[model samples]
Target: MTAPLILHYAPDNASLCVRLALEEMRLPYRAVLVDRAKGAQRLPAYLALNPNGLIPVLETPQGPLFETGAILLWLADTQGALMPAPHDPARAHALQWLIWLSNTLHPAQRMLFYPDQYTSGDTGALRATTRQRLITQFDLLENARYANWLDAVTPTAQACYLAPLLRWPALYGGPTDWFDLARWPRLSHFARRFEARPAARRAALAEGLGRTPFSAPTPCNPSEGSAI
Candidate 1:
């Protein structure tokens, strides 16, 4: 039988999601890093596993899984917790939050923030359009803070990824930090509460990062050329 081995880039968004769940279960696994700066992820060996050349690929006895949402969901299903207790309202609720994170939250923020990182063309204009999507998603979540989406019993997987992004200054530095959490005190409160978990702390440290994930560059909107 193959041990669960995860191939990921430390600072990538999807890697964070798996790290959180892996810690929560205290599962024994190995982390093989793909340092993007050196272009390791695009190497043929890595591409053989995931032709898309994306990070956060999990190689298991069952094969490989990609994408943050699927990776976390696969973990939860194996454990049978944090995903509602079958036929419960929370089952549908948990799925909804996961879908929102997959379809809206992650993509919108990536587009707004990582445009130049991916393309040489004007990312600023695309970021402007994506920013609106992020704000709307944030507002929608705020509108229903009490909806129990963040409950420990079924803590939506969204937090496993989003909280770290919010806290990492390298990712959201400067004036934007004010807007990132100011209007979302409830969400921030929830994030703080979640981050305090032992599992969460372990996940943060497991990447062997000497500093917080926020230490990276914050790109300008794509309208301008790449930040660096």
Candidate 2:
């Protein structure tokens, strides 16, 4: 028998990517809602699972794992899927893109979504700068060899990571008018195709994402306070 997998997540958070991966893997797992709105993640119990107080912590029999990139890499490596073979040359390229997406692109999105975390006041410039930097990052995908990010029939970890990051600008960036997908046709098409997959479709629906999830705004509630 296999050990059960548990994913501690919050809606519309980076956890969404992990969920997509799990769905793609066709693996059975349980989801634990670390309701950010309820300050659940910051609470003592949840912090015990992930000291960083971040969402998307995967609870395995060995222990709880944190960090989105590490978790994705672990899943690919252990499951022997969603990644190229270790001896394959393409494996190196896949690793490179995954790291860049996690370290570079992911942080940029964070800055745009939660500028207050990085800046004490007047986050306008920070948000603007980060947004532009993000656009350039996507441009690399638009012009790179792996413009599709996948030669395989199904979505990979790279695609899973990219999907949410691509949706970041429209959801959190100041206004829809500021950023345009028309600027990067290749990247736009890639997103459309990835989202069309059955696994992607199921994951999106499970996460309460709409057809135009990129344009879906983050839910706001004055009564519920959450830093995450």
Local distance difference test values of all predictions, in order: 0.63, 0.77
* Ten-residue region with minimum lDDT total, candidate 1: 219-228
lDDT of 2: 0.77
Q: Give lDDT tens digits, candidate 2, residues 1-228.
A: 069899888766788789889889988899877877677888999989998888879988778898998889888988988888799877988999899888988998888888889999889999888878877877777788753454445678998888787776775657646777768776667677787888877866667666755433344222223324
Error in Å for residue 193 of model 2: 0.7
The TM-score leader among the candidates is 2
In candidate 1, stretches whose alpha carbon ends up further than 4 angstroms from where it belongs are 116-121, 151-156, 168-178, 208-228
lDDT (C-alpha) at residue 152 in model 2: 49
lDDT of 1 at 22: 75
- TM-scores for all candidates? 0.79, 0.90
Q: Which residue ranges in model 2 land beyond 4 Å of their true spot? A: 146-152, 214-228
Worst 10 residues of 2 by lDDT: 218-227
